[model samples]
Structures are given as structure tokens and as C-alpha cells.
Target: MQGNKIFIEERLNDGPGKMRCRINFRFYMLLLSAVYFTMLYIFHGNLQSETQKPDRNKLSMGVEMQNAFLKIQPPIDIKRKVLASHQEFVEITASRLHVQQVFTTSGAKRNDIEVENSIISTKRTSQMIQKTSECFLPAVTPNRTFQTIEPTFYVYSAYLDRRYNDRFVRIMALLSLNKGNRQLKVSCSFRNSSGSIVETTANFYELCENHGRMYGGFILSCPIPNSDVCHVNVSLQIKPVHRNYVVPETVQVRLPVTQLGWQEFPDQTSGQHENHGQHATFDMPYNFSICVPPLFGDIDVMRFVEFLELNRILGFQHFIFYVSTIKNPDMYKILDHYKKMGIVTIIEWALPSNIRSGQIWYNGQLSAHNDCLYRAMSLTQYLAIIDLDEFIVPHNGEITLTNLIPKLFDDKVCGLSFNSAFYDKKFSKSTSTSRLLTARHTGRSAIFSKVRTKVLIKPSKIFEVGIHHISKPAAEDFKVDKVDTSVAYLHHYRDCVPNYGMKCKDFVEDNTLLNTTSQLEDNISSVLKLVFKERKKQE
Candidate 1:
């Protein structure tokens, strides 16, 4: 102890002694730290490279480029297109009500009848829905829904959605207002931003169901929009009202609708066959004379076929196909095919040679006939002048032309015209037996008038009326037999791709009516054979 004390005293007594001790202690500590750090560093480096695995979400230095080339893209809507918004209304009508004879044939009874225990009978047998019980429908003009055209309006409240996460929600108080102009009472309580009851900056708000009924307008708390309009929450309410005043369970007798959807949809189309009186032989009542009109031109042949088919389906016993301007070979091919099908009677179009010279429109047999339509009445009973592309195939096959068009004899229907369409492109999307047809929706040009054929002509009828050539479909003809899309349709040859045009020229060259408007005119000019220069390189 004495020796240690003496050594400590000596270190405190002199500067050289203390400085030497301090240096030795510092060297030893540095040496120890270097050894410990080297060992720790080696172990940590080994642990990280061996145990740490790759992560899937980690961005790597490389990515695949081939995936970008294989992605599929969306196609453009080709059938029909409209910019912005499209609104459509479909009203269920009495015609939509399909009624079958539970115990009798269709002609045996009429529409509007009550059921009897022994046998079911009908009184007024149209497709209009019969009122069974008082319905909840509001009183409006034209009680029939098919013709209901009351004015209605709706109001959309403005709101701002402030929340970033919420997209939409359902509210129990939302009222679907049907009747207009009577809303007067409502109540709700709500609070707003800035700790106030109705401040604009409030986030939590509520409607007091009573006070906010009509004009107060339900305020919605919404988030500020970073880009788009921020929609907020809203509520509505209406008092409960009793129902049961009108009829229920309206039956609809629907005819198949099968027209190819065109740019203009044909909603008011006829689908039923004619219904003539039952007081005739074979139980048939009407006679129809059908033919292709020379005015219908070469392009209207398909409409003729459809009209004739419909006439027969509606019980037209007698048919006359009046052949007028004559037809090209292609038109004849279509006619001949229908003829071989054991279809119905047909009369070819014929013109008196002298009158033919005078332009049939000016001097034909019915030129002065009944102000444009009924003049041909003397030549036939009921007439269904149709184009070739149209076919009136009935679903039930019970009604025929005579049964469907008794009014044709009435001279009321002046003229009825069906519709045809044209696709903007030069082809059809149809893959049926009519594939590769020039008359497809992607049809060819109708400019070429080869051998003009005219066969369909109706003398005049109150039901069979005027030209639908260049206008939208009319509403009056909704009762006519509606052609089905499948078994029966107007196979519009005008929509054809103009298949074999050069081939047609050869066949029609000798025929009358079309006298080569332009004969094989090639406008391409070839001077000194310079056009062939580009092809020389491949050789």
C-alpha cells in the first residue's frame, strides 16, 4: 500500500510521468476497439448476403418489354352510335298483350270478353290489355300506356363530397317522384361546418325530415375536389299514399320483332296477319293482287317478297304478280326460288306496249286511279304492292293477307311503305347463309340499275299506304304484321356488296330499261408505262 501511494504521488507530482501513462492507456483502448469491430463487421456482412432474400414488389433494374405488344384493345361500336346521351322510353301497350283462345279459334270470338265456365269466349280481340282490377297508375290522357305522353320533369340537387374515400351511398329517404307539381311538405334537421347549424364548411350535416321537405333543399356535406366535381350526400322524403285504383295483370300478345337493327329503329312495324270476315269459301275472306311497282325500281325486289309472304300469311287467297319493267337475271333468280318453294300465287308485271311507250306513271291503267292508289282497284280485290327485299312471315301462320287487310278494300289506306337501311361500310356482320352477299349491311352501292324489274303493285287500300323510301318509320303502321328477324325478314339485296358486278353487266346488256349508262369506262390513264416501274425492283 505504501509503495502504490508513493507511485500515485510521483505521477501527480510531474508532467512527464502523467503524460507517459496517459499515452499508454489510450493505445491499449484503441487496440481493443479495432479487434472487436473487425470481428463484428465480418459476421454482419455474412448475415445480410445469405439471409436477405429478394422481394417481389422490389423494383429491379430490368423489366419485360414483350408484354406491351400482346395486349388486346377495345373495338368501336359499329351497329349504332350517338354522341353524349341517349334516352329511350318503352311503354307496355295493349298490343303487347298476347291473348290465345283458351277454348276457341281466333276468328270464332272477338276481343274484350269475360270468361264463361263452359267455354272461354272473346268479344274485342285486339292485343290491348284488359283492365282486371283498379291499378295504381295516375290519371293521364290516353289511359293506355302505349300512347301515354304526359309531361314530366326532375330536379337534381347540387352537392359537394368532401371525403376522399367514400364513392357512393344509399339513403332511405330518397323519393322517386312520379307525379309532378304537388310536393309541399317535408322536415329534416342538419348541422354544418364551423360548428354552425348551416355553415358551408361543415362536415357532419343532417336533414330534419320535416322542415326540409320542399324548398329547403337537402344540403350535402362534401369534400373539395382536387380534379373532378365532388358530389355530397342528399336525402328526400314523401308521404305514404294508398294504391289500388286501376287494373292489374295486363296481358301482352307480342309478335316477334326481327328486323335488323338499323340507324333508325323501326318500332311502329306491323306484325299481325290480316283478318278478313269469315263469311267466305275455304273460310278465307279477302283477295290480294300483288306486284313489284316499276317505281320501286330494281333495288326494291326484296320488299316485294316480304309483302307477298305477309299477304298470304294473312289469308289472301288470290295473288297477282304483275311483271312490268321486267327484271335482271339476279332478280329472276330470287323470284324463281320463291316460286319453287310452293309459296303462293304471283302475277308478273306487264305493261300494254302502247302505254309502256307513254311512261306507265303518265298512262298506266290506274294512272287516274283513286288519287294515286285505288286506281288499280278494278284489276284486283286487295293489293299488297311490295318490294322484293321485304317478307311478311307470320308467327302463328293462321292469318293471311286477306284477313289482315280487309281495310285495303275500304280505300282508306292510301299507301304504306316499309323501311330499308344502309350500313356506312361495305360489308355485313351476318354469318348466315347470306354470307358474302353484296346486299349485306355492308352492302354495295345502289347506283347501278341493271335490268330494272317491277312486280309488286297494290290497287289501293285504306290499310296499305305510302312511300317510306327516304324517311323514318311512321307510327301508324304499328299494327301491320311485324316480320320476325329469324324465319322472316326483308333480306335487303340493296345492302349487297354488289357482288359480281362485272358479271351482272354481261347478263343485263341485252335486257331492256337499262341501256349501259356507262360502258366499261376505265378512267385510269397509263402514259409510257411508268406505273410499272415500282414492281420492277422485286424482279
Candidate 2:
């Protein structure tokens, strides 16, 4: 009985110990499962965070939105197909809205209706931001004015003139000067790229100073203080020494700056120790360019075509026409067609309303001519400043002006003064009944003189240009050489004018213009056809 009781107690104690051991084992297993799951969750979170991290080189939201829209946007045909099905269109629009919301919004809790409304609001806000951005941003102010009578000067353009050893910025303008205004003090305020402004006294030079005119072209020269600044905005403050004149006390005008000389050879360094003759080293884009003054009134299209074609045949590569007012649509269309073909450039040259009444000649011809002079300065080797009616006809068997110029003039000759040979419109020969004006008017005046003559000038060698002649040469040695009548002459076609002491009744039969008549006709026909064809297509 004693042995049975001892065994039973030992069995009870051993049962309790085994139950405790089983509980401890289950607790350890639970702890291990918790730790493993926690580690797995942390690892998954780290991977997701790495995947969702923003790129360092990511574009702006607007650019990204544009790119994204372009990528998913359906083509025209696909859009048509989608539009055909109302249900599909609605679904696609919804999908697009959803995508846009994803791009534009952050994570926020909202119902379907709220989300749609939010997307619409966000899109509108983005559009407003984009539209206002242009209005707020700072930009270079263009040289223009609407003021009629306050300012006494009209600033045209600013140029970085590196022609001389002392590099300076030349500002071209038109000053209204009276007899009372003897002396003028000019100052230039230059604004650099970093918004820094510098002011200096400028040397003012009137182009037609000795002419005793009311209004004339003037140039203001100021030394460039900062060579590092590539671009600058120049403003001129002109104060007349004698305030007794009609001119204002102080007139301020701002102009857009253009760098000259460097455009011809961009790689070539300026301020080099080179002579005026070394300008030939630079390669010009055009060998020859014709600068026509501001064309106003009704211009005959046939005559205009003939002039362009004849000049083109005479090896004039480019034509720059400053248009003041062209009433004829056909004339504009012809100019546009030529502009498209890269043969012509039409500049809108509407003069200030105040100056138009008492303007110098045909809406500021002097200013326009000088503008063309500077514009074509770096572009072409030679520029012929002439009117639409005049033609520089080479009579020495050298058909092209390109060929004739070199043979006739030397390097020192900067300009060729062609004596005028009047072709009176009323004196048309009975035998000449051709459609072309040049062919129809074979009778030219016997008198050929330098009075009211035209010039073909080397743009680089001439500085300030005039209607009939070059007012200023770039260098002292560079001169205007008068071409003999046998070599070349300006064929001035106009109505009978006996005011200049020349009788239009006495006309010599000179068919010099008819040399290129055949080629001119063909070119005119081809150009007109293409112009009309293009017009039809546009219509």
C-alpha cells in the first residue's frame, strides 16, 4: 500500500512539469511568429518606399502633364471614332480626368463626385497659372512708341559698331531740329543682362547737319563699358543746349540693340589690329542685296514684278522692301510669295502718326534707308539703295552687277554713283509694244548726269546712307567713285518732269533693259503662277 502511494505522487508531479514545458514551448513559438511577421512587414515597406521615391531629374509638373497628355491623347482619326460612340467617349473622358487628377493632385480622401469636381478645379487653376505666367515674366521691351507730340526724337535701332579701334554702340534716331537748336547734349543709358544700368555722355552726329532741315537722321555714339555683356538695352536722353527751339528739354527713347560686324563671321574675334581693306576676308551670306525705300501708294504689280525679276537676273541675291502702306492685295501677295521663296523680306515701316504729316520724304525715307543700311550691313557684301522705278543697268557687256562692280570699281571705291538716265513714260516708242514696261519704254533721255543719281555701296565701308548718296563713309580713304555712262547707269523711269531743266521730248533709243527681257518674262510667269497657286491652296 505504501509503494503504490509514492508512485502516484511522482506521476502527478511529472504530469504538472510536462504541462508547464508544453506551455513554455507554445509561448516561444508565438514570439518567433510575431518577430518574423514584423521583419517581413518592414522589408516590404522599405521596397515600396524605394520604388515610390521621386527622381532627382524629374521635369516640372506642367511639362510632365503636357508629355503625359500627348502620350495618351488619341490621334484625329481615333478621336473621331471615339466621338462617334457617346458611351466610349464618356468613359475615355472619365479615364483622362482620372489620369489628370493623378498627375495634378496629392493623396486625399474624396467621394467620386468630389474627385471629379476637384479635377475640374485643378485643371482650371493650372490653366490660369500658365496664362498668367507670360504676363508676369520680365522680357526685353521692344523699341516702339505711340506717343504723338511729347518727344522730339524717334529712336530707331541700336548697333554695336566695332568698325573702328574704339568699339562703341551707335544709336540711330531722327531728331526734330530747328534753327534755334544749335547744340545738343546726348546721353546714353545702357542696361546689361544682369539688370545693371550704366550712363555715359554720347557724341551726337546729325547726318544731314548742313542741310538745315527741320528733321534729319542722327547717330549717337557711346563707348561700351562692359565688353562681357553680349546684349544691352540702350536709351538716349537728348537735351538741347538752346531751349529756345521747338524741341523738348529732354527726350528719352529706348531702342533694341543689335551687334554688328560679328554677324558676318561669328567665329572671328573683333578688336583685331586689322585695316579697313581686310573687311573682304569675311564671307557674306549674300553677294548683293537691294534696299527699296518705304513703298507707299498704289504700286503697279507688273512693274514691280519686272523690277524684281530684272534685278534677280542681274545677280541680286536678296531684296529688302520697307512697306509703309500697300493698298493692293495682289502686291502684298506677290511680296509674301517672294518672302516665302527666301528672295525678299518685307519690313513693316509705318511712321509715327505725328511725323507722317511733316515727315522728311515718303514717311521718313532717310531713317528707313539707314535702317536698311545697318540691317544689311553684316548680311551682304554690297547693298544697292534704290527706288522701285530705278534700275542699275550694266552697259559694258557685263550682264550682272556682281560681275560689273568688281571690274569697274577698286577696293578703295566704297560707292559707285550711277548717273541718272531718265526714261520718260510718255515717250514710249511706237515700235515697242511689249507688255513689259522696260520693253515698252525703249526711249530714254539723252541727258545723263549725277544730279538726282543713285548709288551702289559696299555696306561695310559706308556708315550713314542718304537717298541719293552715302552721307558718311566708314573710313576716310573709302570714297564714292562716279561710274562713266559707258560702263553702267541708273535707268530712272518716271513721268515727264521738265522741272529739272531736262526736256523729255528729246529721248534716245536705249534698249539696255531689254537685254534680260526674255528671262525676266519667264521668271515673272513662273512666280505669278506659284503665288496664285499657293493663294488658292490657302483659300
Candidate 3:
């Protein structure tokens, strides 16, 4: 949290100065017609083996088989060109960031800059701000801020990696100011600290392209430079942003923690249990489906509700609840919003546990399409079957979830397999008994891996599905689909939230659910709390 704070501060300082000095980008977008033509180019010789033209839903059919790792094809037209030529190399991630200045109006300008006649090259960094909304039309503005007529332009795109999203950004542009005084248009050149002439002309361009987790950036200066206002300094502190639909927990806020593991992972040795993981994602609009056993109580109900509410920002949909207890009134209210939205579905288990297990395993086999045997018996179609708290998102992508998803679907892949990113109950200012219950929300520590949530499969493909508990017998290791999940992810809030100790205390006393071990008790009492007062202030 502290590290993120510093990053935000730096971006704030420098963002404004370089705001107007960005490159006028020229993007080469491929129209559907162009894509169609390209497809024809690849499959021309094989047309004899085919019957019809390309399908309308090409994006949804089978892009995954195409192999994106292949080298890019050559441009169709030799006359076409990249608008601003990017610098080929840089010394470090830091060297690539520099500044170009454009004053609203001035006797002063940035062109008159000079370093050294010999200095010709160095590295550069840049940002591209996408103008989302316009301000001139007017709602409210400070009195001193007057409406003025200026040519209106919008930022179509911004290319920047999350790695540098909200961090301290500083730029030192060499400005060579020419002295003829009065009103004059001046041309200039820039040089490095070493005195070599780096550039000449004034058309300065800035580039910020965030292509998934891996990013690309460049600065191209063309028109001219002058030495008088030769050096322009610009910077900003960009705040870290999670582009995924699923949001992570932060220590910055209080949260209700459910204590289960007596010891946190990575801190213990002998009996250490692998953490659910801190790298999984929960992007918004991701579906969460679970088959709950009967006999769940209020604690389960409330935690799930809280988790859903917090993730509404990321967009959530499609919940399946297999009620363990038919009389769970609290559980019904837990999904009031979803129920209102007509997106929740409920199923009851009519058979005993043993029968249900058998049914589940049978369903799994049939749905996966492994044998010719189970094919006749399969019943359900599940795009994906996932734990309620496990959400999924892309590990990397340039577009937000809304756009990223289409790109994935364009790949025509089914089913995403992801591991659990865990959080545990720790002291937050929240109590279940408080008038307004609250707790510190601690989500992901960091994300170093990705997971898949949306899958293409029939429901029966997996017979019995739930969080992958390590207790089950060994099964074949199947790899999860790998997609750019920058915004598509899962977050297991229920696993971490809820003061399980108190709930367990009351629960064990009443003899419901699993037996709470002494170890569980020790961990809960010592670690969990209902710190609602602090929470109220925060939320």
C-alpha cells in the first residue's frame, strides 16, 4: 500500500507539464474487410478443400489455433509508414522517459534547446492520456475558470503498463532557446547530458502503449528545438490501477477475516499448507457458480453477501447455489441484488451424499467428452463451474475487461483453469455483532500468476466441482487455458472475510458444519476481529 502511495504522488507532480507535448499518433487499424482479405491470403490454396466463404462469427470460432507468436505479416502497401519513428533501444526502463513541452502561448518555446553537437542519442519514456470525457460544455467549474474557445481534441488511447501506471514520473527535455526576442518561430536541437547532439527540429512526439502486461513506449521529436526554453521538466505520480474486473484486497482498509488455516503460508515449515494463492484475479462480470452442500448457516450467508457487494465494481453475474439447508432464509437475502437482477439460479440435492458424489463424478466424466460411454448419460452444459469466491480475469491485456473478453472469445477457447489466490482472517476493525458490521479488507498481496475462469464445456464435463482442496485423490494434471488476463481474474473474498472464529465459536457450541479444531480456534481468536467503527469511517 505504501509503495502504491509513493507511485501515485510522483505521477501527480509531472503529469501536467507534459500533457500537451505528446506525439500525434498514427494508428494502423485493420478493418474487418482487411482481416477477411488476410484470411483469404492464408487459405487461398486450400479453398478446393473447403465448401464456403469465411464464417460471420470468425472472432468467436477458433483464433487460438492460429498461433499469435508468429512474426507479424508485412504491410499490404509499401507506401504506408509509421507516423513517428521510435527509438530502437534504451539503457534501462528509466531512460526511455523524457519530456516535450508545448506552452499554451508564449514569447518562450521549447525548440531552442542544445546539449552538445556530438550528443546524438539517449533513451526516453512517455505517457499517452486518453481523454474520456469533455469538460467545456459545463456543469460546474470554479468562477476563475472561464470557458474559452479552443480547438477540441480527444485522447483516443493511452499506452502505459500497469508496472508504471502510478509511479513517480520525471522528464528532462533539453530545450535550446534561440534569441531573436519578439514574436518568432524558432527551430532547435536537443542533446544528451554528455553533449552529443541528440535531435533537431520541433515536432516532438510522446508514445505510451500498454500492450497487456508487457508494455511499449517511445518519444519522437521532429519539428525543431531552441536553447532559451531548451529544457522542459515534466512529471506525475500515477496511482496503481487494477484493470481487471476482479478487485484485490488491500491492507489500507479494514476487513472481516475468516480464520481457517492456523498458520499463514510461506511463514511455516513442516505443516505448511500452500496458500490459496495471491496471484489469481477476479475481474468484474466474471461468473461465479458453486454447488453448496445443504446445512449452511448465517455466517456463510453474510460473508458471501459482503464479498458480492465489494466486487460489484468489477461486474459479477451468474450464481448457482445448491442449498445444503432448505431453510436458509439468510442465504436467500444474501443474493437479493442478484435475485432482483434475475441472474441467480438455485438447485436442490434430492439424493444422499454418496449418491450425489457418484452423480457428480459421472457428470464430470460425461461433460469432458473423454469416453464414448458417458456421452449418452450427460445432462448439463456448464461454460464453467467454479467456486463462489474464485473469479477469473486475464493476466495481461491492453483493453479493459469489456474489450479484453471479446478478444479472448475471438480466440474461441473454452474453459479457463486458475488457482486460488488466498487471503486470511487478520485483525481488522469489524465485529459481526456491531450495529453496522465492518472489517479490514485485505485482498491480494501481489499477483505473479494468472488463472482461467470462463471455459467452453458442458456442465456434465465435471461431475463434482468445488475449490480444489488438496485432500482429493490425485488426478491427471490438466493445464488451464492461457489467455491475456490483464482484466479477467478471480478474487476469493469469502475465503478471507468473515470472523470465522466467533461464528465458529457459536457454531461449534451449537454443533453445526465441520468441527473447529483447537488450531483453528487459536488462529481465529488471536487474529480475527470485528472492527466496525474503523470500517464505518472508511466505507
Candidate 4:
């Protein structure tokens, strides 16, 4: 009985110890499972981070590149400050016009001078004073010519454009002062028939934005309330933008204002003006005209003839040539002959003594084009600003621009842009019996999109002109249409392709220029013979 009692006590003690062991074992297993799940989560997170590392690096690189670009080409409004006088005008015209803070790439601001109920007057002491609207009309006195200042900017031409209801004078000029970086305040002094001077501030705009050239083109828009102005003088007030820069003396240019007729005429019977009505009953002198860029250097006489004759056959009635330098005397005789025939108008494009011939964008071709645009605005229905070697040829056996233009342009369209197909001189083949250069060059490089393209725009509908496109259109509804290559393309004849490391190998046969080769050759030969014969007589 004593042995049995000792055995039961031992069994009860061993049962409690076995339960404690089981509980300890379960706690260890739970801790190990948690550690294993945490390791797996950490591994997955590391893999995801590695996959996204390249995107983060690229984003950082993009930010660095943007910083570098900002350093190289600064924003247009860098360090821009508004003049007190200009600021006052900005406040007055704020509701009427969108006052833009104009500045150049060189960190100079061009303040838009908009005046309301104010006029600029000069007293006997030769001091400019601001007067109220009551003093807008000065006493009718003898017209006095202001002393001409030294030439700072080359003024090409000025015109009084009354095409829109708002009458403004447009001055086309080359911004040749201080490498196109100098900031100068511009104003216009208008002299009416009564010999009174009315001075007003002008708005300036650069046509080309840092085209990688030292010089640039500008258009000075001077708004005049009254259109009865005989002469307008441009006055420049020089101000130094940089600390080390020296300010030049104030310069003045006197320009004769060529007045243009209004787009719509008042009804004679009712004496009421109509908006967007039929055009004035005046006859347009030319249906289609071409504005050739500043002509310089050694020009191939044969190629010149071909350019004019082919375009003439394609319904170009007039050609305006801005002559910088003609190396060949025969070219002069040809231009003179065409001038006498009333088919060509030559303007002397002499640059300033300090400016080089080809330094500015193709010898200030943008200025010349803008000048030609205004000059031809009143005369031609369509104006094409193209280089000497480029030609707009129609496809599908279309000959004249008369038919093609109607199909391409409507009332809503104002500008037509054409892509270029370069006719490399090396790949030219003598395919035609007429032996014309355009006819011989049948193989052209593949058509490129927006590469060295040219435009044909309605001169009246264009507000600002550029080398390859229109900078501003006259109306918001008037948009540019990119003509399909299947219809037409620009025939750009050059010695080499423009792209770097591009072999002039891939070429397609385009003989659309040969459509009018027979007539072109006859006209060119006749012109050449006449010009040479006349040259012999002069010699």
C-alpha cells in the first residue's frame, strides 16, 4: 500500500512538466514563422527598387539637362524691367490690348508703348513733354525737318497699312545695333499735311528668334489714330541694358509713309462702311508675285534665267528682287531688261558700312521678305517668298498656280506650306532635249517633313512674314495648310544634302518641273539673247 501511494505522486508531477514543454515548443514555432515572412517581404521590396532605379536616374538627368539648356539659352524675359512711362501706358491700354512683355534673347525688354488720351509734345526748349488729349492738335506751322541722327538700325521701308480698321504704320528694319542686343525705346513722330508733329511711342517685335546669327530682323509697329500723315520719322532712345555696355546717341530715321487702300470701301450711295464685304473695285496689278531673297555672290546666269522663266510660265506675273551684290554684269543686264518689261522690280539692298553682306540671316532676307510683303500687299493676289534655287512645282501634270492655288486655298486658308525634295546637283541627269537645269535634274532626295520647307502665303492675310513660314496671320480663322506631297513639293536644287553624314543615295524620280520645260526653255533663251545683245551694245 505504501509503494502504490509514492507512484501516484510521481505521475501527477510528471504530467504538469509535460504540459509546460508543449507550450514552450508552440511559442518557438510562431516566432520562426514571423521571421521567415519578414525576410520574404524584404527581398520583394529590394527587387522592386532595383527595377525602378533607371527611371529615377533618367528623371534626375533630365532635370540636369534642362538646367544646362537654361544656362546656354536664357529665357526671353530675363532681367526684364518695365519703364515707368511704358508702365503707365500699359495700365491705360490693359483692357483693350493684351500687353505683352516683349524681350529679346539677349536679355533686353521691349516695352509695348500704348497711349490713351495722351500725346507727346516738344516745346521750344526742345524738351519732350507729355500733354493731355486737349493738346493733341498742334498749331499749323511750317514743317520743320528734324536733324537726322546717325544710323543705328537699317530701316528698309515703311508703309501706312490701312487694310485693317486699325490704322498702323509698319516699318521693316534690320536690328544691326550692338549685335541685336541693344535695348532702345522707339517712338514715331508723324507730320501731317498741316506741318504739325504728333509723336507717339511704338511697339517693336523681332521677326526671327535667335536664328543662330549675330544680327536679327525687327518690325516696328507705330499706331496712328489719324491716317492723314504725309511723313513719319522713327526715333530711337538708346538705353544700356548691361553694366559694361555703352549707350549710343539717340538716332532718328525719316520715312515716307506709303498709304494702302482699305480692304472694304464705304457704300457710295448710303455712305455706310461694311465689314468683310466685297473688296474695293480697284484692279490688282499682279495675280501672283515672287519675293526673291537678297541676291548676292556668284549667281549662275543660266540657273537664274531658268528660275524666272519657269516660274513665269507657272503663272508668276511679277518678281521682286532685293539686290545685295550681283557678281556677273550679265545678271544686271538681265534684271534691267526684265525691269523695263515691267515683269521685275529691283531694289538696292545695300547693307550698312559696319554690317557684312552675308552676316545677317542671308543678308537680312527676313527684312527683305517683310518689305516685299508690304510692298506687294496692294498689288498681288498671292506672294511667294522663296530662295533663288527653290521652285514650287505642281504634280499630276498641273501647269499653272492659278488652278492649283484654288484647289489648295479657300477663304479660310491663308498660308500653304510645302515640304522639300532636294535635287542634288551630283545626281542630275540630262533627260530633256531642252537642256534646262531644272529639266535635267530629275532625281531628287526623298521628301522630308518640315525640313527646309517653303511657304506660299496671301500677302494681305499675313501680319508678319518669316523665311520658311508666316510668323503671324492676320486673322485667327486663317490657318496654314500643309499641302500633301502627292499634290506638290518644293524643288530645292543644291550641291549636297543638308543632313549630316547623309549620303545622297536614296532618290526618287520627280520630273514635274519638266512639264513646262518647252515653254521655259524658249523664254529663257529669248531672255538670254536679248540681255546679252543689249550688253554688247552697252560695251
Could you say which candidate leads in lDDT? 2
lDDT of each: 0.28, 0.64, 0.26, 0.63
- TM-scores of all predicted structures: 0.23, 0.68, 0.27, 0.67
Query: What TM value does model 3 have?
Result: 0.27
**What TM value does model 1 have?**
0.23
lDDT of 3: 0.26
- For residues 345-437, could you state the per-residue lDDT of candidate 2 as single tens digits? 677777665664554655777877887787676556688999998899888888877667876556567788888878876666647667788
Tens-place lDDT digits, model 4, residues 1-539: 36645654465477658666555556656777889899999999897665544342344535555455446552222211212343344234332222111211012211133111111100110111122111111111111121334444666566676655567888776665354445677789876556677788878788864376656777888888744654577877776667777776666767655444335321212223235555642435456779898798888888888888778667676788888878987788778666544456677777766666456767777777887787766556688889888888787567777678867877667789998877876676655555677877778875454756789987777788788887887666678999888788788888656574344667777767666766666666666766687678978
Off by over 4 Å in 1: 1-289, 294-318, 325-382, 392-417, 422-427, 433-491, 495-539
Say which candidate scores most in TM-score. 2
| Better-scoring candidate (lDDT), 1 or 4 | 4
Candidate 1, residues 1-539, lDDT tens digits: the string is 47644665566667768878666556656877898999999999887654444433433412332222223221112111211011011013112222322222133232232122112111111111122111111111111111101111111222111111331111111121233533313222223333233212323222222222221112223332232221122222333343432312222111111110011111112333122222111111123445443332354333443344334333443343434444443445444433322122233323323222423232222211111222223223444444444333222332333343443222123233332222223333433342122222333232332222121233322312333221111223422332222222222344333343312212111111011111101101111122234235535
Model 3: residues >4 Å from true position, as ranges?
A: 1-295, 310-312, 326-328, 334-341, 353-384, 393-401, 410-412, 427-439, 443-480, 483-489, 494-539
From the highest lDDT down, the ranking of the candidates is 2, 4, 1, 3
Every model's Cα RMSD, please? 29.9, 18.6, 34.9, 30.1
Ranking by TM-score: 2, 4, 3, 1
The stretch of ten residues in a row with the least summed lDDT in candidate 2 is 133-142
